[model samples]
Target: MESVRLNNGVEMPLVGLGTFKVRGYEAVYLVLDAALRHGYRSFDTASVYQNEADVGRVLKELLPKHGLSRTDVFITSKLAPRDHGAGAEAGCLRSLEALDCQYLDLYLVHWPGKQGCKSEDPGNPGWRQQSWEAMEGLYGSGRFRALGVSNYTEGHLRELLAKCRVKPAVLQVEYHPFLVQSQLLAFCRASGIHLQAYSSLGTGCLVAEPTVAGLAHSYGRTPAQVLLRWALQQGIGVIPKSTHPERIAQNAQLFDFHLAEEDMQALSGLHSDTRYCWDPRHVV
Candidate 1:
């Protein structure tokens, strides 16, 4: 797998297995096992995803079984909005306990909360800055190898940079062929922050889109592969989720091929500014 080095000098696999709605120990183990077998060493999860323990258990069992070690994997987990404020460190500690790991490869502030409440308010009271400070504390303590944010807009990032002692290492957001986020991508690149794309396959919409299907046929790849390759070519990390063994295997086969510049431009033209995840404006 290809990798992008974090500002902290930790190398992260460019493509990873994402567990969003994937549930249960059995389901997680199946997908993770398949992903490992297919050469995926990076795994992305969040507290709200509700399968951390499941993923942890599978990792513990499979690593020894496969003769791999904890250092061989790059595990990323997020701090939910509710866990912001004074509880931020506690929340990260709890997540570490849940995952049965000594430290996380990357820890992210899940969202910039609005008001004091994390779920309801669209604009919160110093929530983002507070959360960033807490994250910085954790990172300084060596609890997390790197720290970042998710669903953060340019304005949010600017605020973070202005007040932060430790600049964000990454920005995880909804990105895919149909929602290229070029301006944000360029900003992150210029700022030396890695861009991690969740829902890189267009959140399953690309699988059904005629453009993707036609491109897949022409390229002799699945729609999912085409979409993921597009993101990879743009230097954005991609985490695509699937439980099926075939799909998991297919998703990891992207390194063998390269998407042409013309094809990339054509794919970029497909953007409709569609977003399947939380809206940034509504987030904080």
Candidate 2:
């Protein structure tokens, strides 16, 4: 697997297994098993995803089964919105316990806004900043190899950057040919913050797009591969998930091909500001 170095110098795989709606321990076990079998070294999950323990259990057992160890795998989990305020450190501890790991490879603020703040208004003073402040301490403690944020818009990132004691190492956001956020991507790149793409396959809706289909046809690859490759080609990390062993194996085959410049331009033109998942821009 190809790797990108985080700002802190930790090596992260370019491709990762994202568990969003993937449910149940058995299902997670199956998918994770398949992923490891196919050379996947990174996995993404969250407390809100409800399968952290399941993923943790499988990792504890399966890595050794596959002749790998915790040091060999890169695991990422996020903080829940509800845990945004005073509960941030406790939340990190919960995730640490749930994942059964001494530390996390990467931990992120799941959203730009806070929840259950004392003011009950994220826009109110001291609410939104609370989350990042708490996370900054945890990051300083060395419990997380790197710290980042998810679903953050340019404004959100800008605010965080202005006050942050430790600069965010990454910004994981939803991106695909049809709904790419190019400006946000450029900001992160220019700032030396690694950008990661979630929902890269458009939550499985981009497969039917004529542009993507044409690209897939020309590349002789699946639509999914086209989307994943597009994100990778732009130097953005991607976490595309699948449960089927064949699909899991297929997703890992991204290292062998390249997308041409004009083809990339065509895909870039498909961006419509169409978001397929949760939008955090209005959270304040």
Candidate 3:
């Protein structure tokens, strides 16, 4: 698998398995087992995903079967919104215990505000900062290899940068051809933060788009591969999820092909500011 070095100098695979709605023991096990067998070295999960324990158990049982160890793969989990302030450290510890690992390869603030709090809540900023401090402490203790945030906007990042003791190393967001965040991407690039794309397939909706289909036809590749390659070509790490064994193996086939510049432009042209996930810009 191709990897990128984060600001903290940790190597992270560009492609990983995303377990967002993927739950239960059998489901996680089957998908993770397929991913491991197909050369995926990273797995992304979160407290809100509600399957940390299932993921941990599956990995523990599957790693040895594939002749791998804990150090061989990267595991990333996020701090829940409910854990935004004083609950940060404990939430992180819960992930560690649930994943059955000594430390996490990467940990992120899942949202910019506390759960159940309004987006413009006056306390959001303070809560988020407090969470970062807690995360920094975890980083200091070597429990978190690197710290970052997900679903953060440029404003959210700027605010964090202004007061953070440790800079965020990665920013994961919902990025795809139809929702290109040019300014946010540029900011992250300038700030030395690696941009990781989740929902790269537009939550599986992009695969059926006519333009994407045409591009897939021209490239003789699956639409999913076309979409994932668009992100990989831009130096962004992507986590594409699928339960099918064939699709799991197919998504990993991205390393062999490169998207042409014009083709990339074509993909970029599809950007319409359409978002299939939560919008965090309003979170103060």
Candidate 4:
């Protein structure tokens, strides 16, 4: 798989397997096995996903079978919303323990606010700062190869940039043709923070969209592949989730083809500011 070098000099795979709702030993095992066989070298999970142990255990078993080791693949996990502020360190530690790894290749602050707090809660910024401090400590200690934030808008990122001792290396967000996030992308590019796309298929809605289907037909690719290739063409990393073995294999077939410039623009024209995942815009 292709990779992009982070601001901190760590390389992150352009494509990764997202384990959002994937759970259970057998399920994770089967999906991961198929992913490994199909050339996926990056795996994304989070504390709240409740499947870190399953992913870790399954990887430990599968890596040898694939003739690979821990360092051969990039592992990313996030700190949960409930673990914001003073709980940050413990949260990262728990993820490490659960994944049974010495360190995470990328560790992200999953959201901008605490779990139960209101979206505009005045205390949110302070909590975010506190969390970043602890995360920086972990990064300095080598527990995290890189530090990042997810679902942060430009405002949130500017706030962090103003006070952070160590800059964020990546920002993962819900990005697809419908939710293009062009301004945010420009800002991240200027600030040297790599933008990664989660929910690249717009929670599976875009896969069935007329525009996407038309393009998929023209390219002789699945709707999912067309959608993923759109993001990859722009240098954004993507973690598309799937439990079906054939779909998992098909999703990794993105690197073999490139979309024409006009076709890329056509996909970008579908932007309607639509978001199918959690909206963190109102989080103070």
Candidate 5:
């Protein structure tokens, strides 16, 4: 798999397995096993996902069976907003315990919470600044190899940068053919921050879109592949999730093809500024 080097010189996989809305120990084990067998070493999970223990259990058991160690895989987790303030550090520690790992390869603020919730709670408090301070402390402790935020707008990032001594190493967001987020991408590149794209397949909402269908047919690939390649060409890390073994394998087979400059522009032109995740306004 290809890799992106962070400002601190840590190497992160350009493609990873995203575990969102995936539940139950049995289900997580099935997907995690498939992902690992399909050459996926980077795994993204969060406390809110409620599958950390299952994921950790599977990894601990499977790695030994495959002759792999914790150091051989890149594990990432997020700090939930409800755990902000004095509870933030403790929350991360709990996640570490659940994941059965000594340190995380990456840790992110799940969202810039208003009070502490990312959805429809405008009155949530002490989320942004408090969570950031906790993350900074985690970074200083050397427990997390890298620190970042997910679903943060430019304004959110600006606020953190102004107060954070250790600038975020990454900014994860919903990005795809329909929402390119060009300005944020440019700003992140300029600031030496790695930008990761979630919902890179347009959240499966593009399956019926004529534009994506046409492009997929032309390339003789799935729509998912087309969208993922587009994001990679833009130098953004992508974590596309799938439970089907074949689809999981297909998502990783992107390095063999290159999208032409014209095709790239065509995909970019399809952008409608669409977002498939939670609203940042409610969070921040």
Candidate 6:
């Protein structure tokens, strides 16, 4: 239930349930219901995630069932690259409709690459800038409570910082022990932007690391908890996803324990420049 105050003065939860692959209602409903009942008030989703409606349904139905309301929970959706520029507004509007909310608590530019881009194709190098300009329009309209970017490298962030009239409130990226992204993290911190860590468990790879497992065992916790706690200790927000109810509940039990300074440094040494998600370095 801990929160980080965004630059726009909006509060985002330190931990959230990521609904990236919760495709169908059959699965999404049960998992989300369990999370809400377990006291989770934030959910991360996207336009391409293709299940915003399901997420909205759960929030609309479950929040009140759990004695909560729309304002009690935080919902985030993303802008698809194809929707950059002129389409950006409509893209987020569609998400708002699908999420059954008038406004999003946080809206993010999903990637630095442009529409129809599959790789470093080198086409439309200016698309991100255009999209950011369009998103700035949305941000100014107050339709989105906060705005940010995802998968942006330090270079992309630098470009954005130089051109943007409104500073991004957050920067989300694939961050974990294996890909510590030290420089990028420092940049965001120094710029007063919140860094939201995705794939904090390294897409399940961290759970199997002996060092992480040993730490988990010594602390009487799950490796997943250890990784999440590491992000928190570093003062980064994290969104760890799960399909199982038990795992979802377990991910939320991070407020009680604190990692020692030595253990924190040990985890820091696990960085190997690995990436489980797509790299944005070539977007330019």
- Taken over the whole model, the C-alpha lDDT of each candidate is 0.86, 0.88, 0.95, 0.96, 0.85, 0.88
Q: Point out where model 6 deviates above 4 Å.
A: 118-125
Off by over 4 Å in 2: 116-125
Put down candidate 6 lDDT per residue, 1-284, tens digits, no spaces: 79999987999999999988889887888988989988788999999899999989877878878888899998888998788766767787888899889888888999887767665765544677777787777778877888899998888888889999889999999999899988998999999899999999988989989999999999999999999999998889999999999999999999999999999989989989999988878776
Candidate number achieving the greatest lDDT relative to the actual structure:
4
Local distance difference test, candidate 6 = 0.88
| Model 5 per-residue lDDT tens digits across residues 1-284 | 99999988889999999999888888888888888888898999999999999889999988877678898889999987678666787888989999988889999988776333445454334556777787777788888889898988887888888888878998999988788899999999989999999998777998667877888898898888888999999999999899888899999989988888998998899898788886685444
Q: Enumerate clash totals for all models, in the order shown.
A: 5, 0, 0, 0, 3, 0
Which of the predicted structures, 4 or 5, would earn the higher lDDT when compared with the native? 4
Candidate rank order under lDDT: 4, 3, 6, 2, 1, 5
User: Which tens-of-lDDT digit does each residue in 16-71 have in candidate 4?
Assistant: 99999999999999999999999999999999999999999999999999999999
Which residue pairs show collisions in model 5?
114-124, 115-124, 115-125
Clashes of 1: 5
Where in model 5 is the C-alpha error above 4 Å? 114-126, 282-284
Which window of ten consecutive residues has the lowest lDDT sum in model 3? 83-92
lDDT of 2 by residue, 152-195 (tens): 88887888889888889989999888777878888998899999
TM accuracy, model 6: 0.96
Alpha-carbon RMSD, candidate 3:
0.7
True lDDT of residue 181, candidate 3: 95
Candidate 4 displacement at residue 94 in angstroms: 0.5
Candidate 5 contains a number of clashing pairs equal to 3
TM-score of 4: 0.99
